[model samples]
Target: MDRIILHCDLNAFYASVECLYRPDVAHLPVAVGGDEQMRHGIVLAKNEKAKAFGIATGEPLWKAREKCPGLVILPPHSRRYLHFSQLARNIYQRYTNRIEPFGIDEAWLDITEKGMDMAAGRHVADDIRGAVQRELGVTVSVGVSFNKVFAKLGSDFKKPNGTTVIARPDVSRLVWPLPGERLLFVGRSAKNVLHKVGLFTIRDIAHASPRVLKGCLGKAGENLWRYANGLDDSPVAMVDETDPIKGLGNSITTARNLTRQEEIRFVFAHLAQSVSKRLRKQGLVGSTLQIYVRFSDLSHLEHQGQLPAPTQLEDDLTREAWRLFQGVRVQKPIRALGIRLTQLQSVEEAAQLSLLWNEKKRQQTAQLEQCLDQIHRRFGPESVRKAPGLDENLVSLVRSTGVASLPGRPHAF
Candidate 1:
């Protein structure tokens, strides 16, 4: 039997989720993003109504506003979106256990066994779409194919709640004439090179000499050569608990370059809260904490230090992050700030315990952290946020960025 993969993508996910609560905004030129004050930021998501006005994701929000002044700008509700995402995943589990969430808005499911025929696969996809629409009142697009890349492309064939199938024989007919940029893994720079080589379409690359393509792209060139020919064999592997996280960090590009110590401290506290929440969620502790500072000139400086112990405790992580920040010289306007925790170990499995502190103090600190985590989980992150994080400006900025919530819904671009 030919292997089958189904790529499911939620349409205009953030905007769709927003529409659930505010149906009045449906079919309007709505966008979800940060405040207009952040001049360089772009539309995070847009409804079909906004797309009709030539607005696109990642285009500056100011430009989008200009393109359609009446565009409804809604602050991204990360928590609510996440809640919807969980509902989508739960529905997916009913179909197959071989599921891999791509991000907040997309996932790949191996239903080759469950879906014995193309028609069955389509039925499964339709069922998923109906489930989302019924349970969450959002629409989804599904792409059914024999591999990950084609499955993803199939999902994009239609929009705002649609489905497309890519059988093996139709691969060339469906994909080859598409622009080189449409191929997976081809970024802006690669597209330029391909363009210059007169390889404007996937068909052009498919017919090009392997030696020439490899010479041009190195290892990536080889992969592209295979992709152009519809020869992808990558499997949809379920995300494993033990898989080392790609990265553990927090970063914020401020609305304006900040110089005040209080403002910087406030940002630091926010970052700390975010980082600690991630650590607890992953059930991991870190041994090294790194701080990154990007000056106005774009030059960057980094400071790192070994923590006394591998800790998931917010207070300990924050103290170390602040210590590193203090050591870095701030000679120029700061454009961005970041904090990272590395050298990870499962917190539940770690054998090492603090010995320097007296038993009572250690117990008290642990109890305090446990209480805080409970409050955060039960009410919300803000329900138990540190006082420093409550600064009005800081709260507005964080809420706008939508980073406070856990990864829930699969969002589509």
Candidate 2:
């Protein structure tokens, strides 16, 4: 039997969640964006009304404003969005455990294990969509198909509160006419490559010669051909079946370019704190520390170093990031800084204290950061920062732009 898959995508997630809590702007052309004065300014999400005015996600906030002068811009609330994402997932849990999250706002579910036929699957899709709308006050677009890739594309075929079912017999009629760019992983560069080779539509990719595709586009060429032909067989993994997280990192674009060590250290400390908090939450530690620096000229530098041991402590990350920053050779002022913790392993798998290092001091620092995490959870993220004499303006700019929220970027679901 063909697998039954459904892709659930929350519509305008951030903007919709904002409207649910703030009824005053629910009717207006609202968007969730960063503050322009802080250099984090960009449209994160927009309502349907905003979409009508050509405002799009990740566009410059000023451009969006110009398109619709009355566009109401709201600050992002990450915690709230996280809360709703979980709530929406709870609704999906009622149907199947074979749920694979694509991002914070999108997930793929396999209902094939339930032994449901196409008719039954569509009913389940409708019920799931209706339940989310009724309970969460947010609408979802559901795509019902027999495979994950097609299921995702089906969800995108409709919007806000619609369901699109691409059944076995309907693929040729419903999907082939769409451009090849509509398929997942076919970005701008891939599209240009496909078009250059005369694969302009999904139908073109479906009928293209495999020998020619492999030679021209490499593995991606064959992958797209298979996807276009509905040959995808990837499974929707259960929550626990998902792959272990590779890393935890956070970055921010400063309000002004930073060149001095003091300014860089202040930013690195905050970034390290953010990464550490997330690592603790996941009960993981990283042995490799990396930092990315983007200069004002848009050029970037990234550096990585091996740590003595795996750690989820902020001090370890901060020290390693600072050391890496010191080694970076860039003449330009840095407009942004990013810290990444890779080479992850379970906290239980961490190495024992080194004979060369002080064990008591390491334990003490870990305990302190854990306590601060608890305090931040209760009071707020801004409640207790470990870095002293940190520039308040810099701190606030990073804080307002939460770790999960990046300007001019779309959620890569």
Candidate 3:
């Protein structure tokens, strides 16, 4: 039997979720993100009605509003969206354990082991979409194929509440003529490189020599070349609690160039807390903390410091991040700031605290974070955030700039 992968994506997730509560606005052009006064606000997600008007994700809200003056803008409800995502995942788990959540709105499920053919898989996808619509009042799109890359592409072939199946025999016909950008991992740089070699489409890249592509893109290039040919072999590993973290980082692009010392410190504290929450979520700790600042002129500054002990403590990380920020000379207004934790080690494998005082502090910090996590989990992320970081303008800016990568779908053989 050929491997079968299914990519399921919520249709205009945030917008759809909002429509569940405000059904009257279902037919209107809607966008989800920050308020317009927050000049840095960008479209996070848009409903089908809005997409029809040329509104795209990451497009500046100001421009989007101008294009569709009647656009109904809604504030982001991350907690609400996450709740729907969990519900979607619960439903997916019923079909297969080989499920990989790409993000809050997308996931991949491998159903090859069920011995179902493409038609059966399409039925399953349609059923899942129906379940979400009936139960959660949201629409979803499912793409059925033999690999993650193709499955993802298939899902996008249809829009809100649509499904497309790409059989193994028909894969090339469907994928070849598509633009290079439509292929996974083909960013601007990769696209340019591919173009330079006269390989501007998936078909061109797939037919190019793997050795030549590898020489150009290194390992990543090689992977893309393979992906274009519909040859992905990656499995949808169950999300393991013990997996080592790939990276820990937080960034905020200020609404405007910031010059105040207090404001900078406040941003650092917020970023530290955000990073710590992610660390705890993954059961990981880090030994190195790095801080970055992008000045108004686009010049950047970065500082790194080794922690005396690996930690996932919000206080420790925040204090260190603030100190690093203070150490830098602000010759110009700061456009952006970021904090990252690297040199990761699993919390379970990390050594215990040495000194009695140090041990006591570590225990206390851990307990505090656990409590905070519980509260945030039950209430909302904003429920327990640092008081100083509650500057609405700044918070909106940070939320607007955050990257949202769609979850990876399961790969079929």
TM-score pick, better of 2 and 3: 2
**Best first by TM-score, ranked:** 2, 3, 1
Sequence-dependent TM-score of model 3: 0.75
Q: What is the C-alpha lDDT of each candidate?
A: 0.78, 0.84, 0.80
Give the candidate number with the greatest TM-score: 2
Model 1: per-residue Cα lDDT at residue 217: 80
Give a tens-digit lDDT track for model 1, residues 223-308: 88888887888877764434456347777767777677676766667777778877877877788887777676556777889988
Candidate 2's error at 323, in angstroms? 8.8
Query: Candidate 3, residues 210-268: lDDT per residue as tens digits?
Result: 89999988998889888988889887656443545446887776666678787777777
Name the lDDT of candidate 3.
0.80
Model 2: what TM-score? 0.77
Candidate with the greatest lDDT versus the true structure: 2
Could you tell me the lDDT of residue 227 within candidate 1? 86
TM-score of each: 0.70, 0.77, 0.75
For candidate 2, write residues 1-413 as lDDT tens digits.
88889999999999999999899999999999987887767798999999999998877788899999999999988899889999999999998888998778999999886567777778999999999999999999999999988999999978988899999899999999999999988877779988898889999999999778888789988888899999999878896675766777888878778877877888888888878888888888888898889877656767899988788888888899999888978799887888888888887666443421466887788788889889988998767665453567556546555554232122221
Q: Is candidate 1 or candidate 3 better by lDDT?
A: 3
Which regions in candidate 2 have their CA more than 4 angstroms from the true location? 113-115, 192-198, 208-222, 239-244, 258-266, 277-283, 287-335, 352-413
lDDT of 3 at 5: 86
